[model samples]
Target: MGRWGPRLITLGVVIALVYPTLGDPPRDGFPLSTYPMFAVDRGPVTRVTTAVGRDADSDRVLLSPHLLAGTDEPIMAVRTARTAVSDGRSAEWCREVADRVARGPARVDGVETIEVVTETHEAAATLTSDAPPVSVALHATCPVSRR
Candidate 1:
């Protein structure tokens, strides 16, 4: 019975961990989870996020997606960049991004500098060039690694 008790507890823990995978809402904290960040609906409002570079005159220059390490997951990519900016590691992140881009297939010979910008737009807003961004915030900027 003593040996059986430990095995039963182990089985119970396994079952609890796998229960969420069976249609339950993903969650984190107490026990463990897959960090259900997007488990709930976020509604129609969405913010378009991107990273770009600016010339010496501050003119915006669209950077290649390679800046995000060419990740297949856009949300994860943006979150990582934003976290880096918020954590005050934007300079290191910028260097890593620039290095990745230079080594990527985008043919960006070099990146002089970069910044992470986020623009909020209503999902139903007219997708026109002149619609104007509802809001634009500059998160971080850093000079790219020349190396």
Candidate 2:
């Protein structure tokens, strides 16, 4: 049984890793997740959330994962993009993200310009607030593509 035991364990591990990928839409978890940062809820509390775009009138415009990154991972992309921008490579990251946004099928419409900002909110408090955002840090901007 010793000889077969090791091989059986190896086969089981492989199956577990591949199982999530075998789904119709390819779910992620356990040993096959791309990354599982927020696999579970963190509970209600004050938190800072990063936002992707602002309109020409300087109004907040919501962005989806696919629109910002062409992937179902805005959090990961936001972290990477912020790092790139903060490291004095804003031009490069801006162009890359802008291109990805432009090529996305569900791109935000009617926005002539785009900027990344961070907003802080308290989850326990009421959603309505007359006060300004706790902070508004602009990280990058790109002109909307005419295409």
TM-score of each: 0.57, 0.54
Measured by lDDT, the strongest candidate is 1
In model 2, which runs have C-alpha deviations exceeding 4 angstroms? 2-51, 105-107, 126-132
lDDT of 1: 0.67
The sequence of per-residue lDDT tens digits that candidate 2 reaches over residues 1-147 is 789999999999989877776777667676576354566686754444343655567776666766655578967767765676567776566666566656654546655566755555555453765545555667667776756
Alpha-carbon local distance difference test for all models: 0.67, 0.63
Local error of candidate 2 at residue 3 (angstroms)? 11
lDDT of 1 by residue, 25-66 (tens): 554555566656666687766675567766557666666544
Clashing pairs for model 1 are: none
Q: How many backbone clashes does every candidate have?
A: 0, 0
